[model samples]
Structures are given as structure tokens and as C-alpha cells.
Target chain A: MQNAEKKCAVKKCAMEKSSVTEKVFMSLTGLFLCLFLVVHLGGNLLLFKQDGGAAFNAYSHFMETSWIIRVIEIFLLLFFLTHIFMAIKLTIKNKQARPVSYAVNKASENSSWFSRNMEITGGVIFIFLCVHLYNFMFSQRFFHHYPSMYAAVRTVFQNPWYVLFYVICLSWVGFHLIHGVQSSFQSLGLRHPIFTPWIKKLGVLFAALIFLGFLSLPVYFFFSRTSRRNVQSAISHQLKIENGFKRGASQ
Target chain B: MKFTLKVWRQKNAQEQGSFVTYEVFGISEDMSFLEMLDVLNEDLTLKGEEPVAFAHDCREGICGTCGLFINGRAHGPLTGTTTCQLHIRHFKDGETITIEPWRAKAFPVIKDLVVDRSAFDRILQAGGFVSVNVGSAPEANGILVPKKNADEAFDTAACIGCGACVAACKNASAILFVSAKVSHLSLLPQGKPERRTRVLNMVKTMDEEGFGNCTNTGACEVECPKGITLASIARLRREYCKAKIKG
Candidate 1:
């Protein structure tokens, strides 16, 4: 006999269909954010130049003044929001799926600890993002004028607690990235024997590079008193230029 | 060999279960795992006590009915062996074996070690079939399948609905089981007609059955008796994406 047909409503079908859709959404947004992180790290490397912050301040200035950068910043914020939203949604769905737990869980033998705890790492990174945005992007208390991104960054890194926090957060970001990149590729159905191992290696390398870039900035500024003094002088010089521009405009 | 068994003992589905330790003595090393349990049951019955209840069909490993969580590894410590196929010699003498039923919200323990795996059957019923006209066996030469694809299909088709993957997974995910079914059929031409709807329906049923989402831990793959690969799950992912985008 032919199998009897079962009818489910279109709405129900759509609801069921969205888990795969959610995965696709998370994978794409997460990969795009990875690209954003690479670009961010590249820009952040300017913090290390010995030009007394001129290169970094100029780069920050261009980023603030360019219309394209401003538009991309908005899009970046949207991407972050969507990525976090999908993560939370999928996490809740997964938790609900397994209402009962095993009595003796020996899960570490089968999977990496980092892979199992993506939500925790993602949570830490989100908290760090909020503090980072407050210190550099949204709050004007740290630096009174535009193009003071260098001063704000240097000032924040000077505090020992902030440095420690930044290092810890970057470590978490590294953990999240190492699992996320490969996972997103698999979620997108980009699995292959030859390329899978290489992709995993590349993920680790990218994570290490980003980790080093973020970590070095804090470590370098925290210990190098001379560099801190130089950054102070550069900030004063930039403030002088801002005052001059204001005075010229008023005149 | 002598062993202390800490078996999860529950009277029924409603009763809360607890581990009860039993001392099993004079166990033979040559006995299969189930045979050892058979000896334990025989002793319990002779003592006028209720014997430990577990499921088993074929004494051989093919039936997939026998399963247990021995010492935190599915089907004991040996890789790619079912519970029935496991021999007592592998387990050290005088060791305390912590045996528990497959713990998941979907697979509720019925008595002792036996769980209601009907959830899996429900998932299979959702979309595990291909629509074909009722007829005698069709000639095998009507459709041409590459040797590699045929081999791969046969490999995936070895899954026996054992529920070991669910028991082994940290999240209790049935993705391996469902994906194995999907991969085995979708690899051949006969299964092409319903591939899209099949995956979609099967996945939806899997979710509805309260099986956990796959976290790609590879636990199920490591614990699978048939050595089902994670590649099938990847194929499931590919099929799912294709169905959602195109179908």
C-alpha cells in the first residue's frame, strides 16, 4: 500500500524549516564578522608604529571622516546584532531539545572543550565588545574631540585592569574563532577531505594572528613607560591641531 | 572473574531510579557481555529476586537491539562493536562496571536498561520511504550507479537503528541516525525522486521527537557500532541547505 499522507500546516513547516535557515544565517554572519576582524586587526596594528601615534591617529581620522566607513560601520553593527541574535536563538533551541541529561557525562573525549562551550566564549566576547565600544566608539568622556581614537586606546590600555581584561577577552575571542571558522564552513556544506584539514589549520593561524595583535598592543603599552609618554605627547600635539582648527573656524 | 555491577534499577517509567550495586562472581572471561548478564540474571532468578531487564534480540551483533552504557563509553570501551559482540575478557576482572540505560528525554527508560526507542521509529515513519509502484523486483540493470557511489550507499545502509548514537552523544542528537538514513538512500537514483522532501520531513520529525540538535562533537561517530562517518552528517547538511534554498 502507498504510504498515507500526513498534512501539516504551512506555518508549522516554515517553523521547522528555520533551524537550517538559522544555521545558514549564523554561518554567513559569523564568516563575515571574521573578515571584519581581520580588517580590524590590520587597522589595529597601526597602534604599534613609532611615529608617536601619527599613523594610528590618521587612520582613525580617516575611518571617522569617510562616509563609506561610516556606512560600513552601521552594517557591521547590524551584522553583529544578527549574529548574536541567531546564536542565542539556536542555543535556546538546542538546549530545549535535550531536556534530560546523562548521569555520567564524559564528553571531553569526543569533542574539544572550546567547541562545546561556544556560548560561554561568545558571551564573554559580547561583554568585551560592549566595554570596548563604550571606551572607544560611543563615549566622548575619554577623548573630547574627534580623531582622538589613539588617545582613547592608549589611555585604556595603560590601566593594568583594562590590560588584563583585554588579554583575557582576546583569549576568549581566539577560542571562539578557532571553532567558529571551521564550524561555519561545515555548516555551509563546504566539507572535503583535502581542504578540511587545511581550513582548520588556517582558522588556527588566523586566530593566533588576531590574538597576538590584540595582546601585543596591551602588553607593549602596559610595560613600555617611554612609549606611554610618547603617546601622551602625540595626544597633546593632536589636541593642539584640533584647537588650532577651532580657533581658525571661529575667526 | 569477579565484578561489582552498579546497574541503574528502575521499577517502571514513573518510578525514580537509582544505582544498585550487585556482586557478580565466577564470571567466565570467554562469555559475551550479554551472556555474562545472562548469568547474572540466572543467579538473581535463583535467589527469588527480580532479574535485571535489558533488551536483546539476535545474540549476534546484527540485530541492533542490544545496547548499554558501560563505564561511560557506549557499548563498552571497544570501538565499532555492539553490546552483544563485546566479550567479558575486554573488561578487567574485579572492576566495578557502572551500567546505565540510555538517558534522554526522548528515550525514556521502560524498566531497567530497556528504553522506549519508538521515537526513532516515528522519525523513520516521517520520511524514510521512496514512492514506488507496487510490482515485482525491478531489474537491477535499469539504473546505472557508479561503483564508488554504490559502495558508499551500502556503507551508510549498514546503520541498524541501534540508538547507540543517541546514547553516546552529549546532546543526545539523532542527526547521525537520520543523516545515515538520508545518505544511504539519497546516494542512489531510486531515492532521487523524494530526496528533498525526505530530508526536510525527516529533520522536522527528528526535532519534533525531541532529539537534541547536533553540535558536531563526533561522539556519535566514535561510538557507532557500524562505523558511520561524520561525512553522512555533512551530506545531510548539504541536502538540507539545498532543499531549503531550492525546494
Candidate 2:
């Protein structure tokens, strides 16, 4: 019998595909988020220096006044929202894929616990974004229009419980960023031989600086009693000034 | 050594399951992991307790039949070693071990620790073979292959088709495994003619098999029993790009 011809010249999608294609999409989106982070951190660090927060806030106000910023702000929201949603979706896909349990629980013996549990860390950050926005964004963006903007800001930070909440949320963000910063490079095809070591170090340093800088503010407000002390001093100083004014008026 | 093995017991692909702990008594420290399991199975057979199921063959680490998540690790605690080659010496006398099937979407559980890795074979059928005239085995050594090409091809060829990479991957990506196979054939003169078509087809097959994406975490290489390097993944990328650009 004559053998059938090698009729099919090329193998098409009829066969199974590799996992690379979806990963590439995830990697590309992850890289875009990384770029957004650098910009976001730069904006937030504006609060680092003296009178920095007010200047930054006014700058944000200035941004709101600009048409370009309006466009970029929309893009920023899309970026964060898309990244977070994709992360959740990807995690589900990952979890569903594994089919077996090992006879020996030996793999985690060598790797870092942080790397093993990145999804949990990332989930915590997702919850944190909600709380952060509830107090900060809801107040500044939505609640500010009604009244008592300063009181909202002060009371949120001034109350010990609220201060504690902020601290916990920021810490979660810190953990998320730590895993994200390192893993993002791998996603982006940045596995250069000589550059990888340096990339890891840079990732660690960036994650640490961002975490520490954000953490310092809430902790300072919580511990110092600075706002309460200033109020007491202001009351005494006001009493003296009022007495002087009364005497002068009487004379 | 008297130890408790907390093995995952699933009756079939359709059923949900949990860990079933069994006591394996008087295991020799020198016996390979599979041998230790053999002792336990022998006991279960005499006692008529539906024998615990597991997959293994070619006790010598060459065949890739032995694969499982051992205590949260692919294979056991040993790096660059297959389960069949893992000796009991790695664990202490009274250690309790957790054993389960390779956890990934592409590899479905057949029964207990036996997973259906036929997805891997499907990936192979895609773009895995070089397009050449049939049965006309080209002149032996007709095409001159460079020494470096031969060496690199051999390195890629060293893969034993093990599913450890899938087990180790957080995203359950088969990039390392696919890339190794792709690179092995693509490196030499005999396989060069169909390189582009091979990558496209193989990659497509990989996705069709329901495998997740590679996060490029390099965990697969670190845990690879054959030491299939992540360089293979890079090579795969380079090949895929070349194929996309040219073909």
C-alpha cells in the first residue's frame, strides 16, 4: 500500500499550545504597572520634605485643573484597576492548574517563605487599597465637598485606632511591593546574565525605601502626640494674648 | 525507620480527595524513595488495605516516571535528584512526610499520586518534530554538525520528559520543558529546516493543554531533577521570536 503523503505542510493550532502566550500578556501588563509605580512613588515622596505634603496636595489640585492630568489620571486608574483584576484572575488560573499532592513536603525547605506565599501578600494589598481609599480618597475627593475637610484629615490621623489601621495597611502594601518588585523583572524578560544580580539588589532597595518612607509618617503621628501638644500650647498662648488685649481695650 | 506518610488519596479524576496517613515501618535509610514505598505497599498488600497507588519506574534516575510533590517540593528535599534516586537518608528515623501528585492544571490526577501527563506528549506532537522527507533517513553524518551545536543539543536532549518542572512552577508553566525540547532539535543541522514551524506549533499545543504562563521565576530550573537550565527558556524565547519574524 502506498504511504500517505506528508500532506500537512505545517502544524497549526490543532495541537496543544504552550503556557508562554498568556504569560507574555501578564508580563507586559506587569511591566506597565512597574512603570506606573515609579511615577506614583515619586509623587508620594513629595510629602517627604518640609511643607512637602501641602505643596504636593496643591500640586495635585493643580493637576486636577489641567486637562492633560485628567487624561493621565484616567489612565492611572485604568492601570491600577486592570493590574489588580488581572492578578486575581491569574491567581485563580494558577491555583486550578495543579492536580497532585506530593508524598513528601520538601520543596518549601529551600525557598524563601515570602516567595512561596506571594499571592496571600498580594491579596492583602488588594484589601488595603479599599481601606486606604475609604479614608483618604473618599474624604479628599468625595467628602471634602460637604464640609469639615481639615477635621476629616485630622481626626483620621489623630485617633489612635485610625492611626493603627493605616499602619497595618501600609505594612501589607510593603509586603506586596517586596514580592512584586522582584518578580516583575522575571516577568519582563529581564533575565540578563550580568544584570540579574544587580536587578535583585535594586528591587530589594526600592521596595525597602518605599515601605520605610510610607511607614514613617503614620508611626510618627501615632507616637508623638504632636498635634495634641500643639493644641495645649496654643490654648495657653491664646489666653495670655486675650488678657493683654482686654487690658489695652479697658485703658 | 518508622515514619508516617501522609499521602494524597484520590480515587479518580472526578472525585475530590484528602491526605491519608499510613505508617511505614522499618524503612532502610539506604533504599531509594521508591524502594521505601515498595516496602510499604508490600505490607498493605498482605493486610489487604487497598494498596496506596504511586507512579515509578527505572529506579535509576534516568526514566522520568517518578514525579510528585514531596513535602511541598517537586521530588523530595534534594535538589537535582529524581524521586526514584532520593534515598531515605535525607530524612530522619521518625520523620512524617507528606506526598501528593504534581499540582498543576495541565496534569490532571488519574488516581492518587498518578497524574495524567499526556498533556506533555500532546505538546510534543505540536511543532516538536522537524519537517523532513519520510523514511529517507538522510545520509548518516551527511550534514556536518559543529561541536558546540552538538554539545548544546545534547544538553537539551538530557531532559527525561519529567513533569517536575510543572510541579515546581508557581504558575504551572511548562516553558522549561517545552523550551528544552525545542532547543534540543533546533540546535543541530538535521533539525534546522523546520525550526520555526516547530516552535509555533509546540507553543500553541502548550497553551491548548491548559498549562498556565511562565512567570520566569526560575524555580523550575532550581528544582529540575535533570538540571534543565533556565537558559533553555531564554533559547525558547529567542527561537519563538525568530520563528515569528521569519515564518
Candidate 3:
């Protein structure tokens, strides 16, 4: 009996460590992903330059070729995967914790709707991310569907359906971040009486900025006549140059 | 005043429960929520029906014994008040109040409007006490505790183990209760000796009791009758990290 009790104690300690550790890791990875969003939004701002895609294309080229970026990309992928995995795992346990549902839950009376429905918002963002990566990242690196990143953006956003989808997804991202940023800090135990309220407000402000910043790009490309004309002419000019080079090589 | 009450009824833990509507009349607006229930029970008993088996001890709010998930909010619509302290004036004359026991896997319903909250006692047994004995009472100024720590500890120690936080949480997480216990004890000198082991063991037992992990929704904080802040949870995390590192 003594030996069995000792083994049970060991098992309990390990289980306790992992459960809390899982949450700590979730916080760390979530904060890292938030940082990635800041950097990504900053880089994408280059698309707004009036130079007809030259600066944006150059930025994309450097991003594609840099070794440092490659390493960061690997970490980014890992963070995304781990955050998603932990979310699903935690959500399942949360559901089981309340086997019987409340007959009349006025949850909104106590907490914000976004705070309660993080899984729904997160799942929506994940679905958007899959489509988004396929549209830009995969197409540029693997498919070579467009000559330049800006060209791909121009073509894709021209379709009203894609623009609508992008706008809706960006809104979901805003909802996710509104709760996510401050919640991450709380999970990591970085809270203060005065600073916590400020952190929550700042989180909402940051989420709004991200939404508007990302929203401007697709909206600009879709509606601005100048950008539309410029992209069309730029694509044709690039095609002509490529054909000329092909004929010269044949001779 | 007359009102409709939809109360949950169950014979035993194994039996499934359902809402039983009871029309209660002549209920005064000044009566406490539990007193109103008592009136309903008095009527039920006179009619040779099984009286609603609700739990209560001290009519005062401090005991934390009287809990009911009334009208979707824990302990009724009022904030920072237990059911025993909640007067019926808050409700409309013809209001249909829905009262149910705290719902969680760890807190199984024993009967109508009562759950086995011994999970809380078991968690407390894990490490909620200081085992060391200092035999005699010391001088008043012996420990020299800081005012802020003492106040915060006192605030956290006010937790009544009501399990209202659990009922209010969407995930039915008991982290608020556990964290409150941890914060109060860890803040004092007597509790410092077993801090590391206490946090680990209590958290283990909490998880074993099948409570959900906190999702930082702030629901538990909002619904806690003691007004325990989320900072206690943050402190718990900080303490857990320190313990793990030191270990």
C-alpha cells in the first residue's frame, strides 16, 4: 500500500505540471503569433505605396530569399500549429467539465460575447488563414501563378467575392485579437490593477488598427480606378518583356 | 405578490432531473430568496408532496451554504450577494424565476437544488491548511506583515467556498475558488513553508476532480459573491511557475 501510494503521488505531480505547463505554453505561443501579426501588417503596408507595385514586389522578393525570414517562418508555423492544437484540446476538456448544460445561461450578462465564443472566432480565423495562405503565400512560392506579389493581390482583390471574404475574415481577426491580446497576458500572469484595464483597452485599439490596416489594401485595390488601370498595364508590360527575352534566347 | 417558480427536481444522483413549475402566492417583496423558497416548501409539505430539498444553514450571506442559480445568474440577479441575502423585491410581481443547482461534473446533483460540493472540501484537504504548529499565540506585532499583503490576503480569504464561480463559468472552471485559496495562504508567513507543495497538490486534486481549466473569460470574477479578482488567478499562475522552477 505504501509503495502504491508513492507511485500515485509521482503520477499526480506529473499530471499537475503538464496541465499548468500547457496553459503557459499556450500563452507564450499566442503572444508570439501576435508579434508576427504586427510585423506582417507593417510589411504589407508597402502595398499602399504609389510606385505601382515596385516597392511591394521588392519587399516580397527579399522576404522570400532571406535566411533569417526562413528560420522565423519555421517558428511561425510551429507557433500556429501549437496554438491551434492546444485550443482544440482545452476546448474539449472545457466541454466535458460541464456535462450538463444550464437551462437558461445569461452568460452575456456577466461576460463579453467575444470572450465566451473564442473557439468560434478562432475556428473562423483558421478557415480564413487556410484560404489566405493558398491565395498569396503558396501561389507565389510554389505555383508561380503571378509574376509579382502585387500582381497577385491586384488580380485576386478585383473579384468582389474575394474582397467580401477578405473583409469578413479581417473582422473575425479583429474579434479574435480583441479578446486574445489581454487574455494572453492574464494567462502568463502579467496583470496589474491599473495596467490591466489599460491593457484591455489597448488590446481593443490594436485589434481595430489591424482590421483597418489589412482591410485598406484589398479595398483600395478593388475600388481604386488608378490602381486597377496601373495593375493591368503593369501585367501586360511584364508579359511583353518576358516574351521578348524568350525570342532573344531562341535566336 | 404572486410569482411562478421553475425549480429543478431530482430524486437522486442517478435519476434524471427536470423543471417543476410551482405557483407561489402571497410572497412578500421583502422576503429573502431562500425565505420565499421556504414558503413554497411549506405549501408543498402541507399538500403531502416532497418539499424542495435546497441546502442552507445560516441565513446570512457569509456562510456560503445557500446557493441557487436563479434566473440564469448565480444567487439571483444581484451582484456580490448570496441567495440568503437576496431579497425578493428585485424580481417583478409575476416574474417566472428559474432556479437550478450549480452544474459541473465535479459537483453532481444530490437532489433538487442541491449538489455534492464535497469536491471543494477534498480540494481544501489537499493543501488549504498550514500543518506546522506554533503551539502558543505570539505577540500581535511579531510577524510584521505588510499592510497591502495583509489586506489582499484578507480579501482573498473572504472566499466562502460557495462554488458560485463554478456555476457562472461557461466552462464550469473552479480556478477562481482554487486561486483564492492559494492567494490567501501564500500571502501569509505561516503558509509560505508549504507554498510550493500546496499549489501543486491542490491543482492536481482540482484537475482530478474534473474541473475545467480557466479560459480567462472573466465570468468567474464577475459572478464571484466575494468579489475575488482575476488577479488571484494570475497570482496562482505566478506561484505555480515559481514552484515549478524552484523544484
The prediction achieving the highest TM-score against the true structure is: 3
- lDDT at A209, model 2: 76
Q: Which DockQ-derived CAPRI band holds candidate 3?
A: medium
The complex in candidate 2 yields a DockQ of: 0.37
* Residue-by-residue lDDT tens digits, candidate 1, A1-251: 13223223322454464455667778899999999988988999998898889998888878878999989989998999999988887678777655655666666766788778889999999999999888787764345644477777777877989999999999999999888888888777788989988999998898888898889988988878667678999999999999999999999
Per-residue CA lDDT of model 2 for A1-251, tens digit only, reads 12212213333332322345444555566567667666766765665456625766765566547888779878777877767767677677766665443444444454455666666877777787787778766767776742343334445667788777777766666666665666666654456778877877787777777677767666665554676698899999999999999999999
- Which stretches of model 1 miss by more than 4 angstroms? A1-16, A140-147, A226-251
After aligning candidate 1 to the native by TM-score, how far in Å is the CA of B207 from where it should be? 1.2
Can you list each candidate's DockQ?
A: 0.38, 0.37, 0.50
Assess candidate 2 and give its TM-score to the true structure: 0.81
What value of lDDT does candidate 1 attain over all alpha carbons? Answer: 0.85
The 10-residue segment of model 3 chain B with minimum total lDDT is: B131-140
**In candidate 2, how many Å is residue A80 off?**
2.1
Candidate 3 steric clashes: 0
What range of 10 consecutive residues in model 3 chain A has the weakest lDDT sum? A10-19
